[model samples]
Target: MKKQFLTLAILSTPLVANADNEAVGTPLTAPPEIAAVFAGSAGTARTAEAYDVSPAELDRAIATFTNGMPGDSAQWAVALKKSFTAFEANHPHTFGAALGAFLFNNYLVYHDLPLDDAADAGMKSVIAQYDRLVREHPEDYAAADKEKYINMIMAGSYAAMVLHGHHQDKSLAGQYAFLKSAAGSALENYFKVPVDRVVLENGQLIAR
Candidate 1:
């Protein structure tokens, strides 16, 4: 059915729901933005040519897309962990109800997806878990975090790949830069996270 869904729209995972439980620094916090990683942005995988994708080749493609190039993945994982921790620490929620509503609304994005009953049911189950957690532990999580996280997702989701002015190449880095810049500003100003774009690799903020 093609699912007609993005990750948020499916609610298969809550991006920052359990963020506080993980000691604020862990590998699970970072999954490379898939669309960003697949920046070639071509639908040309489908051609009139005889596609020789067997079960094994299909599996291999999925694995490569999921785990990425193994050695470089570790480096990105560490970067994502550090980056997310710095973001959350600088933003804390003042109202519990707002946090609950924010998470609930985020899941509702998936209702717009075109899905078969089984897929919809599965997605609903996932959302239910997040709703339960957010409702039960409002003190442990924050609305500010949810807002910032959603903003990041929305920005990335909206920023799709584009053919680079007749070059036929998609700019993966451009999408990343746009997402980072948009989310960075939103986290800093809207959500009151003290994020500086110029943070040093040592986790120290630069003097503005």
Candidate 2:
């Protein structure tokens, strides 16, 4: 059954649980107007899928999308590290590829993982790459767009991290608290104010 489930999960249409479905997880809800901006930008290989991905790469991407920094925080961070390294090796900018790397790698910051030198370097590289893209193509990525994408991903990732942390060990109250605080920051930063209420659609914020 375990093997069957794994294969099915991999082969299926990404197995994404709706954000509003508490059975899968509690996603961060943001103001409708603000949430709409973020729903368009989160996720690893899905939202930004222009690059050619191998079967193994596809598997990893599926894991990250469905798992969302659960027990696999360390593994997730490591995979993202390797992705960034390969992107750097390419020399030429594949905008979608770089953007995907940046979006996915940034989620690692919220995961409870100890990033080694390589992983740390990878994180820095993605940040640099994202910044360069923004700078070089302000017309494509305006300041508001950059802020929206970053905050939207942050809100969603931190919310998932908080849920996972609590589920893994109820005793780790401190960690969960920290994650909630981080989620709050992401919400406020993106909305430009603390949102009192939010609406979600398909795990993305629809209305506040």
Candidate 3:
């Protein structure tokens, strides 16, 4: 009976981790230096320094998601959302790119099989939800939010694909080439800028 119960429990366990299933924990804090860089108050050198810390902070969040106690992942998600929300309030013009960078770096971290699989799955889930939202309540899907949703989906899906290539030991040049192309395409589509005018500098995409 014990063996049967154990088998049943194991079988019932989910193969993929869901961020929603996790409880919210401590809020993730964004360092002031990062905010300074986003605000254009910091120098180019400081920009590099601040961005260097950003990845580490994101990794800390990922660590909490994967290894910390139950609800830690959800906590980190909520915390990051809040942190970015506050940052966005202050740096309205640059916040979208900054958020894209956060998603890019966060998705780049390599995780074990199912969790890594979840990265792509999560993007698909976003697409499905957005589709459902638009289908069921067209009025609620405002034009501005529509663009925002599309941008987010692109950033997330691109990052997930890049991470997948990284995990497979794909060529570094190929990965970056794809990223640059994606960035250029996004700028062209959303901002109506010529792709040639877009440049990647210090990990940020800038449109001239």
User: Worst lDDT window (10 residues) for model 3?
Assistant: 1-10
**Pairs of residues clashing in candidate 3:** 23-71, 24-75, 25-75
Backbone clashes (count) for model 2:
6
Segments of candidate 1 deviating more than 4 angstroms: 1-4, 9-115, 143-146, 152-208
lDDT of 3 by residue, 1-208 (tens): 0000000000000011113311111122223532222222222211111122244554444453335434455654554444433333332222223333332233223121223443334423432332332244322222222223222322343344444444565575565455545444433442234645434334333345
Q: Which candidate is the best by lDDT?
A: 2
Better of 1 and 2 by TM-score: 2
Please provide, for model 1 over 1-208, each residue's C-alpha lDDT reduced to its tens digit, 9 standing for 90 to 100: 1221112211112223222331111112222453333233223211112122233543333344336433465553343333333323322222222222222222222122123455435434433343444445444332223323333322222221111111233345554444444434322332222544222222211212
Give lDDT per model, in order. Answer: 0.29, 0.36, 0.31
**What order do candidates take by TM-score, descending?**
2, 1, 3
Model 2 residue runs over 4 Å out of place are 1-162, 201-204
Top TM-score model: 2
Q: Rank the candidates by lDDT, best first.
A: 2, 3, 1
Query: Model 3 segments beyond 4 Å from truth?
Result: 1-158, 161-164, 171-181, 200-206
